[model samples]
Target: MKRTAALVALAAVPVLFLGVFFVLPVSGMVGLGLVSDGRFAPGEALEVLGRARVHRVLWFTVWAAALATAITLLLGIPAAYVLHRLDFPGRTVLRAAFMVPFVLPTVVVGIAFKHLFAGALAGLALDGTPVPIIAAMVFFNLAVVVRTVGTSWESLDPRPAEAAAALGAGGWRVFRTITLPALRTSIVSAATVVFLFCSTAFGIVLILGGLRYATIETEIYLLTTAHFDLPAAAALCLLQLFVVTLLLYAAHRARAAAPVPVERRAPGARRIRRTDLPAVLAAGVALVLIAFPVLDLVTGSLRHDGNWSLANYRALDQVGQGSLVEASVIEALVNSLRTAFDATWLALLIGGLVSVIVTRRSHSPTERRVRAGLDGFFMLPLGVSAVTLGFGFLITLDEPPVNFRDSPMLVPIAQALVALPLVVRTLAPVLAGIDDRQRQAAASLGASPLRTVLTIDLAVITRPLLAASGFAFAISLGEFGATSFLSRVDHPTLPVLIFRLLGTPGSHNYGMALAAAVVLAATTAAVMLLVERLRVPGVGGF
Candidate 1:
């Protein structure tokens, strides 16, 4: 009973925080959708649901997500296998390269894709459609495959593959018969994650697609904010929520279906054959795939009027002739930095506390239940489309108890919501690795609980803590969807600024947008480098 009480006390913080912030906001959106103009409109919602356009958009969303997932898996499985099995030089560097797109702002990605495939970009052309956008989406999300599958990839024992080879199975047969089965859990996990990203994708679709295409997310934003059709927006939100819920349910089942096999061999030590042509070619292609987009962004930023010049960069601070360019670049940059910093620290504190509490009682049933429930809620912000959350926040924050309709902190708070999951996932594993014996040793030595954490726990967690917080900071810095929804008219972030620049039909505007995107990309890359430098021993960095 005493232990249960203690567990409850610990779990209370996360539950209360999530109940107020996460659950209430989403619930309010659903309520708003149903109780519009004072009376319920379930029939209107049902009718909207049956619209042909809605069906078309839903079909498009599923197809696009599936395509993206397939692309990630095709490229990622081999890449994951190579990284998991190969012992070569630059392995860590290759791993970091995979993670770059995951951290790059979607808006920046969309912009980069546009620039890459634009008529003026190295005179390259790709049939004048949004094929570039789809390709970019697949490339940008490849990290999901590597990170998720790579974890399981690392955990795989190579003896199975080796034994299969000894039994007269060819390399292809061995991979199909043995390696594929061993990677089922990681593949499913990675695919679900990639699908979630693709379905809810906004900035990439907006920038690369323009009016040519729209995901469910971009359409919702366009319908609600641009058209002011709350009903249609609500309907879209509901449809999206249903689909996402189904996807997440599939993910949950995939997770439950596969039991991770015990590895007799060290996962880190696994490697692919050095002379394998497929592995080498895949690695080379991946390197080019990752490097070219960034190179395109950088080169575009530096060139101007058929000659290299820094004029576009120099004019980053000036506001232009319309509402789209209402805010200066300096203002946007400062606002982004300030807000991202605050949100990172805020998330670190809240998420870290929740993680520690969740791990405090390993054997308490009540604690386990509470942790599981809270975990789902915290992770909901990740899977729940950003546009949905943005609309929810807009409706709920306009009146009453919390009026942040015009608040500056609103953007970062949204960023924090998106980033909190990253922080928790990163820190939770590190915290879980803390042995009970260490705490018991401290306690036996007359250390109080606080002191034990301060000394023993602090030493172990500091490195991962830095890396995690740094990742949260980087994520918030480049975050775009929530930034678009919550950005105050007077203050914009770098991404919003870049989007506005790209929206205009002038060379200078496009050039300046490219410049700002270059800056955002460079800033993100530098921070990731910092994260690696600060990574604690034995705990993987950001």
Candidate 2:
């Protein structure tokens, strides 16, 4: 009964957050699309659905996402296997390297990818286009497999595959029958995540695509902010939302059907002698693919005008100074930092509160239901397209008792929404793992619930909370979809600045964008290193 009450209380936060910001706003946008003036009218939606341009864009979105997901799985599954199954020198470093892309801001990724695909990169013929854009998205999303499925794959017993080998099963046969089945759930989970990412990709598409292609996200941005077509944007966003929800449903089903005995194992294994060479080679290639864009950005940043110079770095503070209250580029960096910080705080507070409440009384019926509902609500933000949410906020925030049209709070608010799911997912596992005996012992010794929690639960959860908050901060820093719309013109975030730099013509502009990307990449690397530092010496930090 006590636990039930806590869950019910915990349920309130996500429910209210999602209802107002997610459900209501999204529903309103969809309704706005289907209604004409004050009544129901599906004509605009029909027209949008029937257009060849719309179909082409939708097809591009689906196929590009599919291609990206496919490539991620190909690269990720092998890397996950190696990471999960082998013990080697620099294993820790390799693991950390895999997470670099996820921590980096997407805007930084866009700039880096653009530079890597530059016409003169590494004496290779390069041009920023759809191929490079898709390649970058796949690289960025590979970490999803490493973190989600790789963790699970590491837990799987090697005995199953060994047993198959002992029975004269060939390598491919054993993998097809035994190893594959064991990983099916995780593969689905990771694939869905990759798909979701590619579908709503904003920064990469914006920079590398260069107006040649448009995903639903790009289309929505063009429709609303550029063309001022609210109904069309709403309709496009609703389509994206519906598709994403379907994918989320599929992910939920896969997760539920996964075997319940999922276990964690220490990362240790003797090298598979015959397979070691291939594994190492594969890992090398994957690392190069993942690391090249970053390297390109860094190298490109330092050298411009046929020689190495700090001119780009020096110019960062000067750009957009006269046009805005603050130097727009530097202001964007400051805005991104501030928003990331605020988003981290908000995510930690709300996510922590919800995690505690949900796990308080797991044995009670009310608590179970409430916890489930809250979990669903928390995950809603993950499934909802950030582009769709931005459009919704654009339309909704203008009207109502709280008109935040010109508010600086809007950027962080949207960023917090984007970071919420990552924070909750990261923290919930740690909270659930807290030993009940410690709390019980404290209570028996006459400690109050608050005191017991402070001394016991807080002690256990500190590292995870920090790591999770770091992830939240990283996501918010890199997030571009919503921030682009919500951020004030004068207070543009780093990504917004990067996008502007890329859009403008000139080698100087491009070089400066690359330099900023290098800075952003450094920030991402620092966050991951922090997360690595926080790992508890036993359980791997996801």
Candidate 3:
């Protein structure tokens, strides 16, 4: 009974936070579309789904996400094997380099791909086509596959494969029969996450595809903002919510079905062999694919009017020509920093409570089930469309009893919710790994529960806590889709400002956009680099 009381106390803050910020807003948005004249009426919304344009958007979203997931797996598996299973010089640096893209802002990625296609691959004419959009998706999601699969690959026992090899079984035969089966669970989880990200992608599609090529995410934005079609947008939101819920459920089942290992083994990375050439080559290709757009973005920012200059960087202090924006890039950057600072603390507080609530050793079946439900509940933000969240905030939080239209912290609160899932993921595994006997021993020694947690949990979770903070900070810095709807014109985040610069005409505006993207990318990369240095296990994996 005491333990139940403690669990309830621990879960209260996170529950309230999500209830007010996540569930309420999403429910309000869904209600807006389904309810009419104080009565439930989904007929008009359902009719919108029958339109030909909606079919095209739905078809394109599914096919594109499927294709991107396939390519990511094909490229990521070899790279994951090479990076995690082989010992090589500069391997750590290379791993960190690959991870930078995953943390980069989606808007920055969209701009980088735009620069790459227009500048380096101009002759190929890939710009304004689905090719760049698909490539961008691959580039952004490859790290997820690498980290998720690589973590699992790193810990697998080598004895089984070695025994098979000793029996005259070739390497391919061993991998096909033994290694692949062992990796199936992690591969499936990674693919599901990558597919979820690709399907709900907004900034990349909006920037590269425009109206010519639209996905469900961008279409939702267009319907809400341009078409003023709330019912249609809300209908699409329901569709998105349903799909994401299904994906989350599938991932949960896959994880639950995975067999727990009877024995644990230390990582057994070996020196490269003759047979590793294919994997090495694939890793090299993956590196090139990651580096090209970043290189183009940097080079494009440095050049202006067919000549190299720092003029673009110099213009960061000014709004673009003809007052393209209300705030300068530098000012927007300061706003981003301040907002991220607020968001990091909020995410850490809520996520820390959530981690503790879910990781505590449950003494009863009912308690364990409740904890499991809460864990899945917090992860809804991960799969839900960010645009939907942002749009929902606008409609739901603007009226009496919950008015936040003029609140400065509204954007940070939304960003915090988006980062909460990552923070919980980062910290929960670390907390769960702790030996419960240590806590029991501490309690037997007459230490109170608070003292036990402070001495044991705090000691173990400090580095992970810091790491989660950095993740939240970096994600908030690059957040765009939600910020787009919630950020005011006078206090725009850097990403919002960069997007504005891209939309405005003039060479200077374009140049500034590139420069601003470089700044945002560098900031996020630096944070990720520091997080990597902490060497926390399962920091960024799914």
Best by TM-score: 3
Off by over 4 Å in 2: 1-14, 121-129, 258-267, 320-328, 362-364, 536-542
Between candidates 1 and 3, the one scoring higher on TM-score is 3
The per-residue C-alpha lDDT of model 2 at residue 446 equals 100
Worst lDDT 10-window in candidate 1: 533-542
Q: What is the TM-score of each candidate against the true structure?
A: 0.93, 0.93, 0.97
What is the lDDT, from 0 to 100, of the residue 258 in candidate 3? 69
Looking at candidate 2, what is the lDDT of residue 272?
60
TM-score of 1: 0.93
Residue 79 of model 1, lDDT score = 80
The alpha-carbon deviation from the true structure for residue 231 of candidate 1, after best TM-score superposition, in angstroms, is: 2.0
Find the number of clashing residue pairs for candidate 3.
0
C-alpha lDDT of residue 28 in model 2:
79
lDDT of 1 at 529: 72
Poorest 10 consecutive residues of model 3 by lDDT? 258-267
RMSD of 1: 2.5
lDDT agreement with native, every candidate: 0.77, 0.78, 0.90
Q: Rate residue 69 of model 2 by lDDT.
A: 91
Best first by TM-score, ranked: 3, 1, 2
